[model samples]
Target: MPRPLMHRRHVLQGGIGIAAWLMQPGARAQVAAEPAGASAADFWRLARAGGCVFLMRHGATEAGLGDPPGFRLDDCRTQRNLSEAGRAASRQLGLRFRDEGVRLSAVYSSAWCRCLDTARLAFDPHYPAHQIWPALNSFFQGQGDAAAQTREVLQRAATLHPPDNWMLVTHQVNITALTGAFPAMGEVFLTRADPQRPDRLSLLARLPA
Candidate 1:
């Protein structure tokens, strides 16, 4: 069963309030300094070396904790969507990728608006949003179907044999499910595909928050 829906206005306002709290001068510094046990340079190097695949979490969203009751895959407007900060973050993230010379051969996103919006805003000029998978949505409330869906999506990604590198803008749950690692907002994870063991994924780098 799906979770109960909440008022969009309330959700948005609440998220904005939380963001304000976190963005305080001292809090922002702390957030920026939070360690993910990996260095940004190391991640960038791995991306260059192995033709990395980046699994990114969507930017901030105004929506409440999870989806409303009876969430449907085909309809996105009803879902929790991105906020202004999220949109701006997406743009900044894109610029960061561009400045870093990260070339994405293809881009995929969760069907949810926040994920799609992030992908579009971040990498659309280079790699338009081409793929959407239901499995990539959030599992925050433990509603995502990760176990059965990840294998299928990974298989599809494999067949693509994407050029130099590929990017996937998705929710936290999907990223965690695939990499066995949790990614914070705006974080990127680099992984390499091994020919000897196609299913075996090697973690290249976990970009800092």
Candidate 2:
């Protein structure tokens, strides 16, 4: 059977978390594509006001899942990297944040090259590279500790105060584990560390890739 067509706009609700997927026109973006509305403004407001962590999946990859056999973490040549379109999306993401005057206290990336490249490409051309956190690394292939890493993200997020926002450039698996929102490459999810619930993050809104 043919797969069902995806809706351009929709809402997924659960517990105290509410995710409004707003897709912008001409935007290679998130879960659902829609014309921007009040959600976009509110998302930016939260970002600028700080006290939030933006979870970003790395820019689009060349192709394929996980890494090839015998791939090494230190070698980009051995892994799946970003494509031209992905690079363009990444650059646009950084520009969007800059144009909005949003301030991020820290920008972290997974040790993976794709994640690192997304961080460096976005925000600024000379983004001073990245601060690699193993906790944000991909466990997609079942090679890392999902439960432990998720805890680390929640713990760190709880420490962030308002006016001190943060960004974590990580993989799809990591983001899903934290918020249960599977995102597109270069997609950004506005989330806050839920101290009361160490097991989850509060999803505010989602931005396109």
Per-model CA lDDT versus the true structure: 0.65, 0.75
At residue 146, give the lDDT of candidate 1.
47
lDDT tens digits by residue: candidate 1, 1-209? 22235346645644554454344333333222222455678777666554677888887777475667877666876777778977887888888877877777778788777788889888886555557766676555445564566666566556544347888888655665565455556667787655664543455677533
Worst 10 residues of 2 by lDDT: 13-22
lDDT over C-alpha atoms for residue 151 of model 1: 68
Per-residue alpha-carbon lDDT of model 2 for 27-99, expressed as tens digits?
1232332323427778898888889899998987775766899999999999989888888889888888888
Q: What stretches of model 1 exceed 4 Å from their correct place? A: 1-37, 72-75, 138-144, 156-163, 194-200
**CA lDDT, candidate 1, residue 43:** 74
- The C-alpha local distance difference test score for the whole of candidate 2 amounts to 0.75
Off by over 4 Å in 2: 1-38, 124-129
| Error at 49, model 2, angstroms | 1.2
Candidate 1: give the clashing pairs. Answer: 3-69
